[model samples]
Target chain A: MAVLTLAQALNQGLEQALAEHPEVVILGEDVGRTGGVFRITDGLQRRFGPERVVDTPVAESGIVGMAFGMAVGGMRPVVEIQFMGFSYPAFDQIVNHVARIRNRSRHRFTAPMVIRMPYGGGIGAAEHHSESTETIYVHTPGLKVVVPSRPADAKGLLASAVEDPDPVIFLEPIRLYRAVRETVPEDPHTVPIGEASIEREGTDVTLVSYGAMMKETRQAAEVLAERGVSAEVVDLRTLVPLDTDRLLASVEKTGRVVVVHEAPRTLGFGAEVAALVAERALYSLQAPPKRVTGWDTVVPLKKSEQYYLPSVGRIVAAAEETLTA
Target chain B: MLQLLTPSGDVLGEPPLSVDLTRRLYRAMVYVRTFDRKCAALQKQGRLATYAPFEGQEAAQVGSAAPLDPEDWMVASYRDAAAMWMQGYPWELLIAWRTGDERGGRPPEHVSVLPPSITVGGHMLHAVGLAWSARHFGEERIAITYFGDGATSEGDFHEAMNLAAVYGLGVVFFCQNNQYAISMPRTAQTRSETIAEKAIAYGMPGVQVDGNDLFAVFTATAEAIDRARAGDGPTLIEAVTYRLGPHTTSDDPSRYREESEVEQWRRRDPLERVRIFLSERDAWTPEWQERLETEASTEIERAVELAEGMDGLGPARIFEAMFDELPPHLVDQRAEALRSVGQ
Candidate 1:
């Protein structure tokens, strides 16, 4: 297992998927000879040929809409929308057709397709390039939403998404693309779609998060350990088919919880995690669940983005709120 | 626009359709018109859900769909039931969907027809994709998408057209310009003189046909399908027709259209010219027409019975189709649904 960045892991995963399944094709703008805007699909077109790794026109809806038809027509399509912000143009196809095909046709047609978009607000990119709008996809029924915080998980989860019978929204954290590197295993293995990964084991309080915010969460857990506070860190790899059992067990063990995400405060994914803890582990809770997330406003330009994204200090403060209570 | 048989049954051009083929098309038109009228009546009686009657566009739907192989893909809109049926979809399942059941959205596995797209214009890409997939697999199978004059205003329409041409994908963009999109007329939909002319910008051939003339639609679609099969890329066919009935049973034509205009189209009914042509050959008679209507009625009644007979869909069945296997949350929700239903 050679060390690889998150972007390299994703490229290897797609290359392996294309080699393994003749029916699989990758289509997106600049995905061909130019690699990708992020180079996540770098060298794929040259390695696999243009047919399997395609470069499409600058139409998000067309890219997704055509891929939906390809999927319905029996090809497994992996589409890359440049950024999470650009995904709105294809939301109609994603919501109406891709997500509803299997249920609307009653299993006669299934969209065995994956839509990957880089998301998060750490990078000082152009407008609409660094937003975590995964809540919208997670809210849509009949879709599997998976986000990976590490190189190994990105490769494994992507492999599973390509093979899944239904459509999957695989959100890659743009911030973590080059920030972390690790030895990713070879392809043909899968990190199950519905399970969560426990990043750190502790007992005093639990820090639950996913995607880019996991970095800060792990930092906060380390700081809490130095300050004589044992904080458990739970990385929710799969948001839709949430590992509710593992989450509740952790909540019950710590008897306190603090959820974190890069998305806005109201109606964010953190709200759902908090609600789940309240519903099942309320009796075991020593304090009410709290959240350390972005403000209920637009993800600002890079200059002030640090104020928007939850920091380790903010996460530690929230965890201490539960501890003090 | 190309016209083989005029409104008054006078031939302007001799189409390549054989007499036997003409008779077969004539019979199919009669059946579709009968089905269309029956559905409108059923909707009035609250038997079927609000139906989009294709009373005036029969020739456009039936003829354009005639050349498609059963194995080819059909992606049509709500008003193109006739086209869907022509592509070998069962009348029962098509009607079942109108009964507000998801099961009706399902067609037989071998029938390569998607559920009729309710929203406008988005399905055009689906056709392009199906044809693209066919070409990628080294197969000659082409896909046809049916939309209306109103759908031309959509962004997806332009995108689908450009993509199909760029890839030289095997697809037919069949637009039935039926005069009105709800209350708005076709003239207000676009400034272009003809919808077919839009294909020029995309470097594809465009044909405008007398949609009421079945022979003309058949000839145009056959040529387009042939061009697609030959890997010559997509073609756009604008079938200039009229919607004699309201957009759906819920709509009222009197609100936006005049009776005189409707009367003017009534004289050019798609079925009448076919009857006139058949009568000249002594192959059609008053007796034959009566027998055909009787047969169509019986056939429709059988389909209605089957569609109405479907039952026993329990609450759990609602969750069955969302995923291959229900996720943990859906499983919990399914149980909750069953409990709410007192099961």
Candidate 2:
């Protein structure tokens, strides 16, 4: 095991996947020489050669559509679309072809591909770069949406995504790329998709979140513990194949729930979690479920970006509301 | 224009394949034409859903697809059923798809054809990707994509061509410029002299052929396919043709086009010219014509029966096919879909 950042873990993970699976090829803009803008794919082109790690033209739809065909043509392609906001150009391809191929061909011709993008705000990045639109993919049928919170999970979940039979939207938390450093296994390992991890153990209330929000959720849990109130933090790694069992168990035990995300409030991922809690665990709930999310507005420019993202104070305040209720 | 046969059934250049292969091509074109007419008739009779007839463009579809190896890939659009069938998509499944059955989209194992792309230009990139995969893996196979002239207006068409040429991907962009995309005439689609000329912008060779002549379309497609297999890079072929029938079952040709124009195309019918070409060479006969029609009738009837006779798409079917394995949420939704129908 070696201590690594989330970005390093992902780079090593992709390197490992390339070394093992000859069919696995990386396609995206600047993925070759530049190693991607954020350096998430850094040093991959040199190690794996330009053939395997392709540097594609700057067309989102072209990158994804070509990747989809490559997947159908019997190669496992992983595409990077730079940022979440830029993914809109290829949204039609993802929704129509990449997601529909498996169903359209009746499992005969499947697009076993992965579309990776660094998402969420608070990086003070330029326009269209800091947008948390993971919910759009979550709402799309046939597309498996996943998010990683830590280094080990990022590496392992990526491994699982590469080998999956269906298309997976691997949403990397941009803010957490170098936010935390931890020791990850050197040998190959996979954190299976579709399962949630309980980051902290408690009983008073459950903090439900995924991706970048996990950091703030964990901080809220610490604050609650120091205040003598126990709080459990639930990190939902896979949003599509959601770990409902773990989510319900945590809610049923605590009986008070607070869902947090950087995306907007209306129909955000938190809405689904909140609705599920109300539907299946209504009776088990001692307090009504609360959602701490960004406002229903365009994620503003980098200026005043702090006002837009879900802050640690906002998460703690929402958790306190659930506790008081 | 690159052509091997004139509009009057006169051989102009060397035949792309042997006479025996030419006979087979004629038989397949006749069969697909019969099937196409039957689908339109069925749609009129309310037996099938809306039908996109490929009557006038038979040579363009069949001829281009005839040269592909079975292992090669084909990404076609809704109006290219003849091309899709030639590439191994079964008649029954194509018919089933027209009848609105998802099961019809599934081709048998070993058929490398994708379900016909309904979107205008979206599927062209799929051909680019298939070609990329083939080249990346050091495979000799190539991908041929079929799209209409109207599909050329879509941004994806540009991207596909540019990327394919840039990467030296083995692919054939076969555009059947059949004079119109629904009510919009081909002249309104683009200002370029011809769809084939657009390939020049992408740094690839482009060839326009008489789409009505089976030998002409076949020869052009064969040359492009050869170039692709030899790793000479992608090529775009524009088959100039006109559709005799309306775009689909719901269309009215008289409202937008001239009847005299349609009559002119009738004289240049792809099937009749081939029949003339074969008959003058003593390969066609009255007895053979009767047998071809009878066999076509039988084949189409059987496919129609198979398509109409399938079991109803129950709740399980609706839920299935989305993913290899159902996630927890889908499992619950499937149960709910079943319960809603009281199953």
Candidate 3:
């Protein structure tokens, strides 16, 4: 086993998927020769050749629309959206066509494609570079949304996304690209979509989150431990088709919950999580579930983004609200 | 033979019809005419949902659909039941949809026709996609997609045209320009002089034909299909027809279009033109004319009974056909819905 960063894990995962499935092809801006803007596709072009690792023009709609055709043409396309913000241009194809194809055709046709987008805030980038718009994809019916918090999970989940019969929106946390190092096994296996992982076991309060927010959630859990609060940390791997059973089971064990995410507080994925807890495990809860999230505003540029993104302190405070109640 | 008769309902120059082909074409056209009328009446009586009548457009649909090889795929919009029927979609399926059943017109597997697209320009893109697939898979089958003048306003139309042109895929873009979109006249639809010329922008040949003339519609479409099969890329055919009825039975043409415009188009009515062509040529005798009406009415009655007798579907059907292979979660969701409803 060798230690690899999340970006490196993604590259290895794609390489494996292409080698495994003859139908799988990688296409995106800079993905061919330059190995993607973040270098997540580094060395893939040389390894797979330009035909399989295609570098596309900067037209987001064309890229997505063509991929839709290619998917219908029996190619398992893994299309990369250069950045999360740049993906808005292709949102129409993604939401209207890719997400709804199965339901619209009533299953006459299925889109076995993966749309990869680097998401979430940090790296001191300018506006639109860092935003968690996972909720938008999650809200769309007939789409499977998956995000990985660690290097191994990223590799495993991506392989599964590529193989999934339905189209999958694969969100990669940009902040965590080069942040962590872990051994991503070769001949990597798949992780089931919509399942949550329990990062740390505890009973005092459930500190729930996913993607970039998981970093802060882990930090907050550590701080809570020092303050004599045993926080149970649950990392949601996929937003859509959420592993509600795991979430409810955890919330039931702790009897209290604090959900966090970098996306805006209003109508965020966290709100869905909170609602699920209220509906399934309401009587088991000792106090109301608290939500720690970003302000309901556009993701500001580097200057005030720190203030905009949720922090460990904010999560800890939210968890403490359940404690006090 | 491209067409054995002319639009005035006459046996045309050079080609003498054996009794069989003439009888078939006449019967098909009559059935479509009656079907269009019945749809209008059903909509008026509230027995059927909204309808897109092909009353004056019978020749356009019948002529174009006649020559299609059975294996060739068809992609159509809200109208075009005549073309769809000629391509072998059961007439009962169309009736089911008009009568408010959702499963109506859901394609039978292996029939090669996609369900009718309700959104104006939606299925045009799928047509391009399916054509691309056929070309990639080395399948010789051609895809013929139908849309209207109003569909040109949608972005998907432009995208589809550009894609089909660049790919040189086996696709026929058939635009039935029926003079108006609801109440909005063609003048208000586009700045281009003719819808056919729009094909020039995509670098494809475009042909404008009198949609009321079956011979012209068939000959032009057959030539386009031949070109597409030979790998010459797509052709845009603008069938310049007129809708003789309200946009739907629910619409009142007097509100937006003048009665004079309607009267002028009625004078050029496609059915009458074909009847005249056949009568003047001595092909439509009083005896053959009686048989055509009787045969078409009997066929319509059989389809109506079959559609009315089909089994009723439940909500589970909504979730059932959504995938070729059902995903585990959706299977659970379907089961949950069934249990909740106490089924």
Candidate 4:
């Protein structure tokens, strides 16, 4: 095992996947020679050869649509969108074609592919660079949406996403790319696609979050512990096939819940988590479930991004409300 | 423009096809025409859902598909059922699809045709991908995608064209310029004089053919397929044709087009020109024509029977096909769906 950043872990996972499967191909804009804008695909083309690591034209829809076709043609393609902001052009292909091919063909054909995109805020970048829109993908059926918060989970979850039999939207937290490092297994491993990971176990309240927000959530758990309140921190690695059992179990044990996310508050994934708790484990609640989320507005530029993101302070306040109630 | 046979069945030059091949082409067109008419009738009888009739574009579909190797891939739009069938997609499957069953989309493995894409222009990129994969695997196989005049207006068409040209992928962009995109006329679709010319912008060879002339379409498609297999890259062929019937069973062509124009196109019907050419060459007989029609009718009848006999797919299939192995959330949802249906 070696300590690696999330980007390095993802690169290793891709390299491993390419080495293991001849049918697995990587295609996207600048994913080859330039090693991708984020360099997540660095040195992949050199190692795997140009055939396996393809650099496509700057066409998001074409990248996805062609990948869909390749998947249908019996190739396991991993397509990369440079950023979450640039993925809109391919949304039609993703929603209309990629998501429905299996159902449209009645199981006779399946698109076993992965679309990787770097998501979430905190980096001082251009207008479209910082955005967390996992909710859109989670809302679409026939797609498995996965977001990993740590280096180890990034590596394991990416491996699992690549091997999944259906199309998967692999959302990588842009902020966590180099911020955190962990000992990742040298041998390829998979964190199951539909299960949640318990980062810290506690009894006072459950703090549910995924992707980049897990960082602040973990910090909030530490702050709550200082106040003599044990806070359970849950990292939902996969958003679409949510680990409702684990979520319910945590909420049941604590009898209080606070969901956190960086996306808008109106219809964010947090609302779904809150609803699930309300529907199945309402009697176990010590107080009404609370959510700490970004406001319903476009993710602002760097200077104002702090106000837009769910802060550790906000998570602590939400946790306090759930505890005191 | 390429033309081996004129509109009035007159030989414009030396015929490139032998008498036997000409007869086969005529027979294929006749079969497709018969199938198209039968599908229209079925829709009227409520046996099938809305049907897109390729009545006048038979030669365009058959001629283009005739040149493809049986193992080659075909990605066609809703109006290209004739092309799909010509590429080995079963008539029964086509009928079943029009009956709105998902099972109909599942063609046998040996048939390389994808289910007809209902959306405009999206399948073109799929053809490019299939061809690119074939080339990557060092296979000689090529893919041909069929769309209409209206589809060229879609952004996907441009993207597919650019990618096919840039990658030098083994694919043929077969556009049957049938003068209309549903209610929109070709004039409204693009300002360009011809769809074939658009390929020039992508740095590929482009040609317009007499879509009504079997010999011209077959010859052009054959050459394009040969060039693709030779690793020379993609070719775009625009078969200038017309739609003789309404776009679909639900459409009313009278609302958007004039009958005089329809009457004018009817005179240049794809099948009639071939029929006249065959008769003039003494290659066709009245008895043979009658026998061909009877055989086509009988085959279509058997297919309809087979399609109608199969039971509707169970609701479980809805959840089953979405993923290779259904996840827990879907498992719960499936159970809820089953309970709601009193299953």
* Candidate 3 lDDT by residue in tens digits, B1-343: 1343444455446544344554466678888887777667767777676888878888788878777888787888878898898888778888887776655656566677766767677567667656756665678888898988999887777877877787687789999999889999999999999999999999999999888777678778988999888989899999988888888777888898888988888876776766665666576787877887787778877877777776656758777654445555677888998998998
lDDT (Cα, 0-100) at B72 in candidate 1? 89
In TM-score terms, candidate 4 sits at 0.98
Query: Candidate 3 i-RMS (Å)?
Result: 3.3
Candidate 3 lDDT at B207 equals 90
- Candidate 4 residues lying further than 4 Å off, grouped into runs, are none
TM-score of each: 0.99, 0.98, 0.89, 0.98
Best model per DockQ = 1
- Give me the runs in candidate 2 sitting further than 4 Å from their true place: B13-17
Of 3 and 4, the candidate ranking higher by lDDT: 4
After best superposition, candidate 4 residue B172: deviation in angstroms? Answer: 0.4
Docking quality category of candidate 1 according to DockQ thresholds? high
Which portions of model 3 miss their true places by more than 4 Å?
A25-75, A84-97, A123-131, B1-26, B278-282, B321-342
- Model 2 agreement with the true structure over B189-281: per-residue lDDT tens digits: 899989999999999999999998888888889899999999999999999999899998899999999999999999888888888888888
TM-score (chain A only) for the predictions, listed in order: 0.99, 0.99, 0.98, 0.99
Off by over 4 Å in 1: none
Clash pairs, candidate 1, are none
User: Candidate 4 residues A1-325, lDDT tens each?
Assistant: 9999999999999999999989999999999998999999999999998889999999999989888888888899999999999999899889988998888888777889999999989998899998898899999998999999999999999899888889999999999999999999999999989999989999999999999989999999999999999999999999978899999999999999999999998889989998999999999999999989999999989888888998899999999998778
